[model samples]
Target: MNIDDMESLDEETRKEIEELRRITPEKHGNAFFAQAQFNLGATFIKNGNIEEALEAFSNIQHLHSPKLYAAAQYHIGEIIESNGDIESALSIWRNINHSDNPEIYAAAQSYIGFVLFEKNDIEEALLVWGNITHADAPEQYVQAQFNIGICLSEKLNKEEALLAWSNITRLDDPELYAQAQYNIGSNLLERKHVEGALLSWHNIEKKDNSEAYAKAQLRIGNTLTEQGDYQGGLLAWCNVERLDDLEAYAKAQFKIASFLISFEYKQAAIKELQLIELMDDAEAYAKAQFNIGILLGKNSDIKGAVKAFRNIKYEYDSSAYGNAQYRIARILISNNDLTDYTSAKTCFELAREVFSYEARSYIRILELLEVPETKSFGLSLLDLLNIVLDIVDILTLNFSKYADEEKPFERKLAHYTSTYTSNLLLGNDKNNTRPSSFRLNTINNVNDPSEGQLLIRKLKDVKDNSFVPLAFDKKFHAFISCFTFNHDSLNQFRLYGKQDNKEASGMSLVFKKDFFQSKNLIGGISYLSIDNTLKITEAISNINVKESHDIQGQKIKNENDDQELVRRSVMRCVYLDPTSDYFHLAQRNRLTFFREFGDNIVIKNGTKQSQAEYEWGVYQEYIKIITEKFEVAYQILKTTYKEVETEINNVRFTLGSLKQKELAILVDEILLPLKYLIKHSAFREEQECRMIYITSIDRPEVTMEYGSFLYVEYEPSVKDHLDKIYIAPAALQHKRYFDNILKNVDVPVEVSGNVFR
Candidate 1:
């Protein structure tokens, strides 16, 4: 049977017939067997029995002969083409086209063109179809030309489309010729040749009873629209709608909306969009809602805009939903007249939940509302003012619970106040009060705790607009004592000395200076000089007999020793002068001492002897005489000896003399001790002797004139004796005794200050 006969079978019956053909034996030789099978497969293909037809062709391949194989392959290609397996069909056709069988080769070439045309390979398809130059070429070749024209027209190759279609127009089939004319109209429309498009489309006979006539009318209208004729465009779209296609209607509504929007008639555009909304397409509804929201927002009807935006669901319109929520929150914040903080907060919260990644601006809005000033605004406007207050109280209480944790309520309060103040300043609202400067003094009077109860009481009376004062009752003197000591040693020196040694010691002396009256030394001595000569004789005899003997022996046995002692004694006078003019005289004495000594009497003894005998005795005795005499003379001349003695003790007179401008006195008086003990409970070595001189030169004319004399002598035989003679001033002698004992005990110095206590 031929393909035309196979087309008459029902699809199921044709499949069964092809299946029977595959299993049944051939009635003739190989050539006839192949031919019969090929015919059977063609019939299956025409009836859409592709699977069964493939099986029939597989049986033909078993012959193994090239001529038979080529014929079988050609049949397979035709079946594959009918089945719409274009790639597989092309492969099979290529194999047959190379075969030696002329009939098989021609059939393969014709089928190849059909497959290529199906793939939209118009050029290759037309090339293959053109090889069939004979008038008797198969009907499949005629179909290939028509398909090529459709492909060319779709790609806007107008000339090529016309040529392919014109070739098919020569066919005898009236249906095929109508299709070619319709495709030529499409090609001219794509090229924007409106006159040619109308001509080609009008060439199709509407009476032919095909879909081509309706399509041609649509094309002609669309061509007019492409030339900037919107009325014509709508008419073409109306033609498609008249055909009762829902997709075309929806598309037409969308196109009208887009066109209106492009023309800057947004309101008119929205009306067209409403048509799409009525159509119930969810995507279109979402877009229409967003556009309406934008239009309303632009018109500043923010509430209406927000309602429109919120109409969109989150899933279908997340971006628009988030944007709409943000807009509502921002508008509410800016309006301020609404003052509905609750609604504002809700809007922002919903915005953050829906679009967490882009919610920072919305979050800032909520934060600003929570500030005390804005919250006050909400309290004023909100009908549920009590509930708002209750919530704030609860938050404040909860916030205080973590006040001592990582984030403190005090710090947060400070931060909030600052933020509120900054925002108020930025808004430049005159109703908002500027933040006041912090008044720390209101909290505590004295900057530190060292102030006494007097300051504390003052602090208690002081109050500020913010913060309460704290009163501290107990004295802070105890704390002060932690860093300070009574300094009993320093106090003793202050009280007993004729002139507070602090003044003489280069420290500020705080004493009632008026209590001790100054007096002329000459007048005092004159008043008490009924026995001045006797007093001098007594002072000279008071020098130790042994010390006097040693002095004489040192002077007679060594001229150098004698001269050095004289030089040092004279040099001591320089320190006595407040003006220090005697320094030149002292230097001359020093040179005389060095020249006379000249390495004799052992140079080592010079320093030791000067420090011990001469420095401590004559030098110190001269200073002591001056100090004592001055005190005594002052008392005798001013008050009386008994009255002065009551105020001061340990005074003795040494020498006195008169100068041109002033009367000078050398006196013996006890000064602070310069004594230290051997440490570690260890006695000083027998060869080590410690000596201290408790006297100084006193010159009222100059400050810092009085100083203690100290000397240490190391001599095994006289070491103990040296200690006894090295008495300290009556004021600080005990301190020296304790310091010596403690040092000998090897107690650490850190504990020395507390040792006596």
Candidate 2:
């Protein structure tokens, strides 16, 4: 109630009470009169008339001893404490020794202890608080136990402090319990028992005290960061829910920004710092603006960075304002623009004026920045800011530097230019040179005919050699440059040879024994290398337009035995159909060639056939190279087959008959040559003996003839006639389907044992 309201009521009540005290009949009852006086004291106390209440209660003590007297004394002590007379309050409470009023006695003793604690008398406070053992005063007992822990912890008696906190067994008083636990955690953290400390903090219930809970979460993040688990620390900080404490929240956000900057996430760091500006905290807002200026300058947003620095008001944070001005000067000086030098000098002078006491120290550091030896210590931007913030009081920097804080981030330049200082740079160190590889030019030179002759002689005359299995060919011998062998059950292998020199780097070939026609072999080959030298007058695509004219030019060059012509290998595609006479004469021809003295097979043989698509697609590629204008050596392949010509049809037939069904009808016409040569070999051991026969001449009736064959039929009007057909394996279906599950439920099938075994 207002003082006027209480005075108005007190004046009328006082006159009536005085008249009743003077005119009351003493014979009727003095007991009734005493009760009426005691009630009057309570009314005075409620009206905030402390002196009058004391007088009324003191008069009752003379006439009679009642519970009202004890209540009045308790309130009198409270009024003295509220009025700032703590000593007087303590004395009054200490004299209230009424044994009959256990509640008042217990509360007065607790109040005396609290006052002693406020006065910094730790030993006396602890003793007085420990004396409150009233069973009816659970709240007082809990508060006393908590305060005792705080006193002991402050004195560095950690064990004793924790024991005192543990004595508070009251679960109903959540605020006191949480406070005690928080104190215990703080003590444990001081002792370097990090895990135990975090456990104790995590035990605090957030539902009880939200401010304390937020603090615990922030501490967890700081502790993790000190331990060098940076990512883990960030996760803990992110979980800190905003509470009543704006200062703690700002601190948490600032810490998050520092961590992000250290990890090179500069943009994210800037955003985290900017969050502080939304809060009402002037100090946090100024610090955030200073950091934002540094980050903007790093990003090369020069004007934006200057504006951010200039926006830092001196009244909010004098240190931040001074530091921002210093940065503005540093940026302007580094910019080296003639127009900005005058402004830069002005900024530096203003900064000095703001920090006059430390002005010389800053200037000395700036001079040291010019010395290469002192400047190249490689301190990061954040580190420089931290050192400046230190020894400056405007910034309340409380966190102590731990071991991880000692490590600074790597320095980095703002721009990637050659004419920059070596003060800061960021990137992993790597060697400029490429990885080392074995040199092979000296012994494997194609120009030396003696080397070629030696390789052929060794391959034909090796006596004690068993054919090394293909699977065991991963390792190679230096002497034997190239070798090949066929699988035992599959005779679809050919051994090709080549001089392993730089000249043969781009040339490739492929061969496969025809599975359908066991007595015949069909294959294709082409050369797709470009001969582009500065000497050539015409563009590469226009080099060999007329087939015969190009062939003649190549022949003339070969006849002259030019160095370039000597290294060029023959590019040809030789196929033997069953109806052709060469199929039966191949074996006899081979014997005759070997019988008539030794054959120079080294000139014809090359690397073993690994990818059939390379050789089979060469014809289609030759057509593509000239038609689509791909650069290739003009002398390699003279013929440029038209799309509808017989040569392209033949090439398509050979590739479509392979076991691979996906490439049956190559979709992209432009990919005929380049795509074919670049495809990885789909060769596997199980597929070695398999082959397919495809025909597009006519749509025939489907029929199965062999034990492992399946025939398919296509109507005449079918748009996508799939011509490739391979025989199915025993006990297997070629059709594909997905297993359906009802109600969109997933069913797992567990398969046991290895299939291969």
TM-score of each: 0.31, 0.44
Model 2 ranges off by over 4 Å: 1-7, 10-38, 62-67, 80-88, 134-136, 168-172, 228-232, 241-243, 278-280, 313-319, 337-757
lDDT of 2 by residue, 1-757 (tens): 2335455465777675565455332654545555566676677777667776666655554234445455556777787789898878777677666464667777887888877776778899899888777384777777777777766765767788898777765374776666666667766776667898788678777776666666676777888886877787788677665554565577677778878876789999999988875454566677777778879988988888888888887787655666677778767655655225456556666665333323333344344345453332111211332232321111111122322333211100000101011001111123232222111111122222222122112212332222222221111111111101111111111111112221111111111211011110111111111111111111100101010001011111221223211110111111112121121100011222222224332211464332323222332343343323212221112122121123224434554535123321221111122211111112211111111112121223223345622333211111011111111111012111101111111212111111211
CA lDDT for candidate 2: 0.42
Task: Please report, as a residue range, the 10-residue window in candidate 1 with the lowest summed lDDT.
Answer: 566-575
What residue runs in model 1 are displaced by over 4 Å at the alpha carbon?
1-75, 78-91, 95-230, 242-247, 257-272, 277-286, 289-757
Q: In candidate 1, how many Å is residue 408 off?
A: 65
In angstroms, give how far residue 115 of model 2 lies from its true place: 2.9
For candidate 1, lDDT tens digit of each residue in 549-609? 0101111122222221100000011111112111110111222233223544322434444
